[model samples]
Target chain A: MDSHSHPAPTADVATVAARWSKKAVVVAGVGAVLAVVGGLSAAKDGGFGKQFGFSYLQAFMFFLSLCLGGLFLTVVHHLFDAAWSVPVRRLNEHLACLAPVMFVLFIPILILAKQIYPWMQIADPASDAALHAKSPLFTPGGWYGVSILLFVLWTFVSFQLRRNSLNQDKDGAAIHTQNMRVHAAYGIFIFALGLTFAAILWMKGLEHQWFSTMYGVYYFAGSVWTTLATLYVISLALKKAGPLALVMQRNQFHDIAKLFYAFTVFYAYIHFSQYFIIWNGGMPEETFYYVQREQGSWWGIGMLIVFGHFLIPFLAFARIDAKLNIAVAIPVCVWAWMMHYCDMSFNVMPILRPKGFELTITDLGCWLFIGGVVAIAWLRSLASHPVYPLKDPRLGEALGIHFHDEGDAGHAPAKASK
Target chain B: MADSNIDYTVKLGLLAEYATPAELMQAAEKFREAGYRRWDVYSPFPIHGMDDAMGLGNSKVGWFTFCCGASGYTLGMIMIWWMNAHDYAIGVGGKPLFSPIFSFPVAYECTILLGAFGSLGGMFILNKLPRHYNPLFKVERFSRATHDGFFLFVETSDPKYSDIETRKLLESTGTRQIEEVRD
Candidate 1:
């Protein structure tokens, strides 16, 4: 094996983090103002409180997806003991740390739960057996309690995982790597539960009459795609700053892009699979959801998602070069984010604004509100240690990787003696 | 051409062996930039950047797959409509004879089936696989390509290929061995 490249020395982690923390503060400040503005207007506009409730849910879910997906990626990084992603793993760790902030964010949804969830407002369970059957878990109290538990679970595990990683930055002990890997292996199971339960409880619970086991996976797929797209932008920004440009290689981008592509197809596969099965059953209850979506202006948005969310980005990022090329990748990432926002809106907004489409001030405010808080927390957490793991055993492996299969021969060692 | 083909079992190409994939990759870049076509690189594993260096473009199979899927979907739609409206004229619980929502399931399946086959068939035809014979297989050392070897084969047919010039280029690239392959 070739012992070729090693990571270049870098400025202190404290210094590099200051650059991002300022941006985080600004984003948080803006988010705080938006939350206040959106909150006050919703209170005053009593007629549109229901819309605000759902819009808030939509924005909240979108931001939650990013953090949940970040946790999932961190687990995968450790589970596979991935070497290529070491430089960027800190970004994921910080996002995963946003689990606490997400916990606090859930309170808003609880306050708006009665308006958003149909089952919560049901007069009597005796009249509705389906709602009654799932009442043990989906009850308002049960829903809030179990969801809080899920977030608590997520925050605890995410915090522990980040601590283990930060500790490794201090000491390159195999034990630290080993402990985190084991923790990740099991943490994934808990994270899956959190994601699955959160998806079913919060988003799917919007229409209690409608149920699909694949709903959780749909949320998961969205999380992974959005998480990766966000990471790509962060990595691009870091590289542009001239620090990570020397330490990190383009190979990481290509690898992450490959993963982004897989999740994109996985999301479509899950989306289509649920739709295909439900449509084939031809049952009135399940089919009604599709009918509702396909009939109105929602139909237009649905078609847009099919093309924008899946087709265009799928085709654009299909190539190896496209994933590795920063210019092409950024536009595709932005498009995917737009489509992700559209996907969440399609899920949430149809309950109120089914007429066609409308982007209210509250919707814009809520999005900025959730995004700003998480951005602030995740960015501040970056300074916990070095931008890259200072003592990671696989740092060399990351530094030496070739981004593409046909990478320049100049990068490889003198020759393969084998 | 016939006389030439009849002589000496037919001259296939010049087969050059490089000690490592890196060397073969370098030779590939040199030949590609020198504008030689009708040549290929073989190694135990793929070398990064070989496709771009060889001036290869994206595969056209995606287009084939797309065409097949679109046609399959259209065909499914027509079948469902014709059977319900004309041939059988059966009522699906009084639903419209051509309800597109109900037809989506079958249309989706058909699209996937035909698209998958299109890609498989397109790849096989484009690559000319299941080929019965190639003169390069006559070389005993070539078999190591699957295990541990790197090869760059420049066909005699390439316009840039000349025995003396090609031989010198391969030697300059530090090829471990070079030989003329017979058909």
Candidate 2:
């Protein structure tokens, strides 16, 4: 596989990264201006501080999905010893590395925690039975401590994975592969615990009175679904840009698209199961969450999640060829971003804007700001490393080239062109 | 060995054997370009990309699965609505007599059950698969298809098939074995 020489890609990585970095700064600045203006405009309605708090939290959770999703992908790659994902593993690593950036961006949420979480603001927690029952985990100290711990765990896992991968590129060492497997073995447990806690504390904690055990996996299903869409587009762009053209084949795109398709059904299954159980039991505590969502335009947003998020993607990509068609894939990926945004809003925005679903300028500003930061960080990570693992053993398998070492006469020496 | 009867001398096709799956795939591609419709490649195991090499299109079984699955869902919903809401009205938990939400689990199950039935039945119908016999079965070497052989067969019925030309094509593909099958 390494014997074939590739023509350099038309696009330069450093120049592209530099250009995008400058644009990201501008985007963040512009986002700040828009957020301030939106906040001031809504001063009389719910106070500027409150509006900023809700908008920031919504944007925070939305972007966090990509990070958590990236972490899941990276961990699973090692766990399954997957060959098809070897080419895209580097991209996912950079995505997971954004955990530190997310940790820094989380400052605003920490600052506005009291404003964002009603449980924190309640004067007498002992008065409310729900708050009193869950007093240990929902307390301010517990919340902040757990939040910081989740970030620390994510950064350590992702950075270690990337470090071993980069080292392998320098010297084609099998030990790095074994090391990554170890990290993934322990990292998966951390991921499940950390993700569940983050969802429970950050989003589900908004409704302190409501009860639902399925909330964590529900958020998880949507996160990975959105992440797969983002990965599809990224892999496509990088392949066209030249760096990944050699390693990426139709096999990569087809497999990624198929995984995305599976997640679509998985997300629908999880969301519907949660709804069905709640709707069937008709418990006051569980029903209250859906009841609040049924009000005003929230009802329409819920319907959108059902149809737009589930049905459209399901039916559109039902054909076998649709997964491989670029025209069909790009549109579906873009639509996934929109649906995931609506999903995030459906989860976080209902408490703040109880009347209905509305897209505020503050929301857009926050989304742009966080997205810009993440893009710059990801691009820097991309520029600093070889676009793909240069010497990973599976690289040969991924490219459809089989290697026969010395003394391995048990296998045929035939060359099969794929 | 005195069974050389002229009455049974009907040419069914030509069978050509290649040493490996790679060569077989290359030959399949050539046969596709030659526009030979009634032909196929046989191997002990499936070769990836062989479908493309053979110029085969997507199977039509999906239509059967989709249509049957849709009917299964619709019928399930209607059956529940008729039985519970109309024929025998029984109130359970003061819920509506019929709701898609409550009935969804059953309907979804029906969809899977019928969808599976459709696929199995569709495959049988499309492949004409309760096959009793074929002229190829008479070729002793052809039985190796279930073992280690990689063979390509082009029927005499195919428009592009000429015994002389097809034999030459197989020779060009680097195969040493060729034989005719009688129906």
Candidate 3:
């Protein structure tokens, strides 16, 4: 077996990150100020407050996708005992760690819940059929209770996974691996249920009357799809930037791209099914959601999603070689971010600016502010630790090393015999 | 006993035996660099990186799958449209006679079905499969290819093949045995 050398110290990555952190702080400040200005102006008639509420909710959901995507990736890595992703696992852990930050971020939405969610304002639940049927969950107490519980469950699972992982970096013990498996065993359930519930409460709740059993998975598929693109760009940067050069291999990028390709189809599959089922069922209650989205520019945005989100990436990365080409991959990654923002806007903006898709200062501010905060938090977490798990048992496997066992001692070592 | 019925007249190729997969891989790289086109390596089990060692690139089987799958979807949509709207004009539930929405489930399944057929057919075609004869079948030692043996065979038809030169190249890779196969 070939032994890979230990990764060098992360001083170089840390230096670059320090510069980025400063820039991120500036961006975050600018975004916050802009969002505040937009909010105050709109508050004259509560137009901007409602706008601010919906815009922030959209941006919040977008970032939440990344955090949940991170947790999902980390949980599965342990569950499958995957080797190829071992190099990128620490990045995933730090991303998942942002769940607590997301909980803090959720405070704004909690305050604006009434402004954002109309169902909360209805005097009597009995007056509204859809609202009444959904009863306890539709109630403000149930909404806030379940919302807090989701964050708690997510933060717990994300921290447990990361704690075991970081401890493994210290001791390289099999026990850490075992402990993670125990967490992941239950973590998968938490992830599925928690993500579904959050999507229902926060985004889907905007239209409390809407009904789609596939809504949770629809959000999940898109979230992970965007997350994979983000991971690809980050891992590639780290590889070129020197922290992950030794451990990262060609196959890692290829595999990541391949998974991204699969999710492109998967996201399309899920969203299409959601639409197809409702369209076929032809129920006015459910069909109203699509009917509203089909009006005006929301129609164009929907078309953009079908082509830009699914078709373009699906075709662009279809070739095996294209997945490894940084030229092709970087552009697709950027496009994926744009597409996901559009998707989030399509879901959230339809309620506030039902005429069409409008890009407001609040929208941009909320996006930039939340994105910068997450980036700063993620960079701080990344710089503080070893860029990759230093002592992972499967690190060698990820580096493409093949070890022959003691049973093969009788065979002549190839190079020596040659 | 069955093999005794045939006569060996034509020379088929040159074969070299390696003790292990690592040696086979090394020899494969040498042959690849030597620019021999009609050669292959055989081992008891699949070897990773062997394709690159032998200078092979991505397979072309994907084209077959894509084209066939696309056609299957197109054909499926057309089949539904012709049967329901163009031919009979039956009204069911007052839905559009041929919206891609209603036809999609069937079309998607057709894409998968024909895509699988394309994969199987492409593999068989590219491999030139259902082949009934090979001179290597008569080489007793080559039978170990299914067990512990690792072998390399360079066909005489290769543009680069030369009895002396090929033998010297195989020898340089540290193969212990080399034999000339005959048909």
Candidate 4:
């Protein structure tokens, strides 16, 4: 091994804040305006409450995944004590921080629960056997309680993990790393369970009569799939802007790109498995979901998802080098994000417009609202501290891995230390 | 012995063994820096930076896997569609012959199957592997390539190579042992 060591660089907080604050203000401002416009427009549509319910849900699922999936990645990062991920881990933490924001967003859904779930307004629960059977869990009170508990659990766990990561930036203590490991091991268990239930609560409950055990996994697939897309987009943007240029290596981006490829395959697996199982069984209740999807523009979008989300990406990222190849990765990531939007749209929109595809102004507005607002919030959190985890012991190992290409190896030579 | 009357196994090259990864890496660097092309490095376990030291890019097998996977998926889809939709038209579960939905499992499975095939195919092609014997096998110390030995072997065919000079270079680079490997 050759001797080469340098102190990890930290971003100037004031500088980051100054650069991002103006953009943040504009994004959040536009988001708030569009959301309000979307909400107001929904009031004029026939069954205004119902229209808003699904439109809001579409936007809700899209952004909630940014948080949920980011949290999942963050906890697992800690659980593994992954040295390679340390440079990019803080950004993942920022995304995970959106869990609290999602909770705030979830409140509106709760207030509109009756409109969102027609069953919440059921007149004679005694007459409906299936309704009666699920009454204990589906009661307005029980459902709301579960929602609260789930978000609370998510917020607490994610907050702690991020807090630990940030704290290590100050002390570089072994204790923070050791503690996060324990938290993450359990955090993953909670994430899997809570996300499954959250999937059921948020999207699956739309048609109360229909259910699939695989429904939760389907959402899990899209959640993480979309999350990876979002991660790729944000990290690449940051790198290009030079905020993360110094701290992040080609390997970090490459590793996350590899993850994006993996989830592409995994998303297809779950997607295919769920559809095949439901189609194979041909049960009325189960088949109804696919039946609705097989019609109108929904069918076309579903096929787009199959090819766009799965096949195209699977082929695009076939090589480990694809990870480092920003040209290939950026386009593929953009496509993947588009596919994820379609995935979320396909999941929620088909429910509201069973007969055909319907595009409402509110849907567009809500999307802008969520996209801009969430991006603003994430950027704020990003600027609050050093972009990289400067104090973590693995920071050295992470920055130490070198690339063969000398073209962009502007940093000091990262001798392979292992 | 006269060159034509030499023992049947032609001289392969010099095989040098390093006691540690550092020594092997330094030697690899020296060899590459000195513009030696017909050469290779091997260790019982993978060593980081070895690829850079040898001036190698990523393996080409990834493209093989992609092509194989794509072909597998396309072929699998056609097979399922032909069997269910066109040739046989079996309507199981009232699913259309080419539901695309139902055929995905088959297509997905094929993608994985052929992708694996591609990986194996790529491995064999890139490594020029599966041949059982090497002249290096005749060197007892070279047996450690699969266990503890870290080796740098420059073929006699290399333009810069000479038995005496190569051995001297190996010795100076901290290799514990060097031996002539014969075919």
Off by over 4 Å in 3: A1-4, A405-418, B1-8
Order candidates by DockQ, high to low.
Answer: 3, 2, 4, 1
Pairs that collide, model 1:
A251-A403, A405-B47, A405-B48, A406-B48, A406-B49, A406-B50, A407-B48, A407-B49
Clashes of each: 8, 0, 0, 0
Each candidate's DockQ score against the native complex?
Answer: 0.25, 0.34, 0.38, 0.33
For residues B75-136, write the lDDT of model 2, one tens digit per residue: 88888899988899878997898999999988898888898899999999999999998878
Q: Cα deviation of A329 in candidate 2 (Å)?
A: 1.3
Q: Which tens-of-lDDT digit does each residue in A34-124 have in candidate 1?
A: 6556656766544445756777888899999888988999999998888888878878888888888988887878777887788888888
Q: Can you tell me which runs of candidate 2 are displaced by over 4 Å?
A: A3-11, A402-418, B1-4
lDDT-better candidate, 1 vs 2 = 2
**Residue B66 CA displacement from its true place in model 4, Å:** 3.6
CAPRI quality of model 1: acceptable
Name the weakest run of 10 consecutive residues (lDDT summed) in model 3 chain A. A409-418
Candidates 3 and 4 compared by TM-score, better number? 3
Q: How far is candidate 3 from the true structure (C-alpha RMSD, Å)?
A: 3.7
Assess the local accuracy of residue A111 in candidate 1 as a C-alpha lDDT between 0 and 100.
Answer: 79
Best by DockQ: 3
- After TM-score superposition, the amount by which residue B167's alpha carbon in candidate 4 deviates from its true location, in angstroms, is 6.5
